[model samples]
Target: MMDSGQNKNETTCAAAMNHRVTCNTFEPEGVPVQVRYAIFCGQSGIAEYEFYLSPTQHGCVDVQLDWLQSAYHQVLQWLNLELASGVFRRFLCSDPHNQAPELEAHAFSNPKHDDPPCAVSWVGQPPLPPAKVVLWAQHIDDPKGIKIKRDGATLMLDRGDLSHHWTTNATGVRKHSSFDQTQCIFEDYEQYLGKHDMTLADHVIRTWFFVRHVDVNYEGLIVSRRELFEKRGLTSKTHYIASTGIEGAPPMDRAKVAMDAYAVGGIDNKQVQYIEALDHLGPTHVYGVTFERATAVSYRDRKHIFISGTASIDPAGNIVHEGDVSKQLDRALENVDALLKQCGASLSDMTGYYAYVRDPSDQGLIRDRFKAILGDVPVAVVVAPVCRPGWLVEIEGRAIIAENNPQFPVF
Candidate 1:
């Protein structure tokens, strides 16, 4: 599903195989504004889909909902996919123009009939209306191995005791300051994992942190995270869960940070593999940060690859393409491509992605550029600053490569 206006020659396949999960990005024609849509195809057919709409000025709530619904249905029809009753995640950025109210209203109006609860996030100011939205539909068997529960705005999905939890502006036990809130979040996370008989160090794979003012408070978030990790026997020298920290505001006015995480319980080391890009990137902890560049989980039917928030940092830990957004985006994609290859996969296997842009004006250009290169991949673009001021863009994504295919290399 390539964008009609994009150059067909721009697409490339690193490795091609039939009966594998296929991914691509596209932009539909007649849409007044530019929006990037990522489509995914799995064994059971179109397993997931995502829409990344650019920021727009405040508009009528009804009109916005109508447009969104129409666009969503159009994509489903184009791809021959249907909306199934499963989990969907959405992230909407707030601004001075009251984008949250409009988004919330739309969200409430479109309730999940039989679908899983939608985890919503009202973060920092993005240039467009409805900030960003991510929807995923599982088309496989019924929810036999999965269980979902919603507590307030938090949605907890349990895959046979391996739980994934997402919450916005978490109310900490002591929400006095940034550090206190950070501590409170970690404490609660620890307790949540305990219920499933899993500890933080061994089972947690990734975490995302949205700091109100990341440049100033990133250190505090790191300190708190490190302290919690240390308590669970993880250290800079050892393995720490992969994470992303960026500038964004939570829904709560007083809250300074928001968090979401993925963890797996009762899985041995053989089932989970932590990956570090070979010769293309440096260890995140080399500069006092802690995380793997990627993690691969091997299941019976497929291998799931999780790439952390990647930027244009070279193998030696120096920021590449210093001040150029275009070059930085290319470098970032190159880094991600290398990581995917390491796991015996490629960009075509991506399920969905989140692209964070520091400059609002670069949104359209970047979206078009990515579509040209990646070919109809699902990408959610949000106007948010990277943790490092020098970095212009950061991307994180999940990809699944079907197992048992002769062409799909086994890790």
Candidate 2:
């Protein structure tokens, strides 16, 4: 749905030890814009990095950085970037297995914005691992004001006072059951949107939920989300937000669930398109869940597509290739292909990928198979459980396509 006169290009590569990186460039109105993302995996932990660049007047470049890691320190040194400013969201995963590292953190920094984000001092401290902190930078025009709010382990970032909203869990908790905790999270999210004069049903585009014991509790999580969506009048026919729910612990010891979300205000409904995969995959709601398989945001000159966490499920809502990892992966990739083609895109347009594997031993096999199918597209493989116990892996990715490109037919 993008207009004419824009250009986009993508490139990907892999470094030593299975580190992958990608660069996506866009040219709109004769201005060059670029984004780079890297994923590094090690024996100790895994890390993901993102950098954004835009040409600006006054010879000063506009840049933003976002980093996520299971364990920090090493990744910072590897990237050689300063971590002086930004906000950090931490979570704890895996309680019984002290052997598996539980601390995971995401930091964002935007140097051109208002003052850098500062640490919010809290009173009591829990007997848990220290929270890993980092900074994130973003590119925004002169803004009226930027506000930060913290409640217990939750942090909210209000950019330009109302244009953008981000909410994430700073630590983990276990005071309530998983269902109760999830409901509370959504309630708090709705309240935040209300204060900003926005509603979750119309503005939210993407959401990530990390739950402890995902295999056993994913259905309950889905039920809670569906109830919230129904209350807001957002159904499968009207379109639901894209989301990912995976196995991971909150930074706190007893917390069963944690969530992060992104929303953009003041956009026309026509610019946002909810996509289905050309009759090859079933709608998520038929299985008692509520989410879009993919969502496309059409700008004046380009279209940005976000694909959700996908596996080898067929149109009947049944898992295919029940016990074969290779076949499951192949079918998963085919599903993504269909989704992209429906939106006038192909695998070559992908910017980056995050592939989650349930078994650590299957990492190499998945990696090779992924490279064989998509060439060198940037990919980060992490050892995490999927929502279903029988599912071996899940993959998510993003793509940007130019409307004027004659090689691709407009959908």
Q: How many residue pairs clash in each candidate?
A: 10, 20
C-alpha RMSD of each candidate structure in angstroms? 5.2, 12.1
lDDT of 2 by residue, 148-211 (tens): 5543333445533224455655222433777777788887777777776678878888787877
Best by TM-score: 1
Worst 10-residue lDDT window for candidate 1 reads 8-17
Tell how far residue 113 is off in model 1, in angstroms: 9.5
Model 2 alpha-carbon miss at residue 349, Å: 1.7
What TM-score does candidate 2 reach? Answer: 0.66
* Consecutive 10-residue window with the lowest summed lDDT within model 2: 121-130
RMSD of 2: 12.1
**Stretches of model 2 off by over 4 angstroms after superposition:** 1-115, 118-162, 170-175, 404-411
lDDT of 1 by residue, 1-411 (tens): 344544323221111224455444445444433445443333433233455543233445445544555555555555544443234445444452255555556642232222546455445646443434323332222223346667554556655524555554454535766677889988887777777677777777777788887787778887777777777778756787777888777666677777877666665666677788858898887787777889887654467788999999987888899888988989998898899998899887886677888888887778777778876566666787898899998988887776643333222
The models' CA-based lDDT, in order, is 0.64, 0.55
Q: Using lDDT, give the best candidate's number.
A: 1
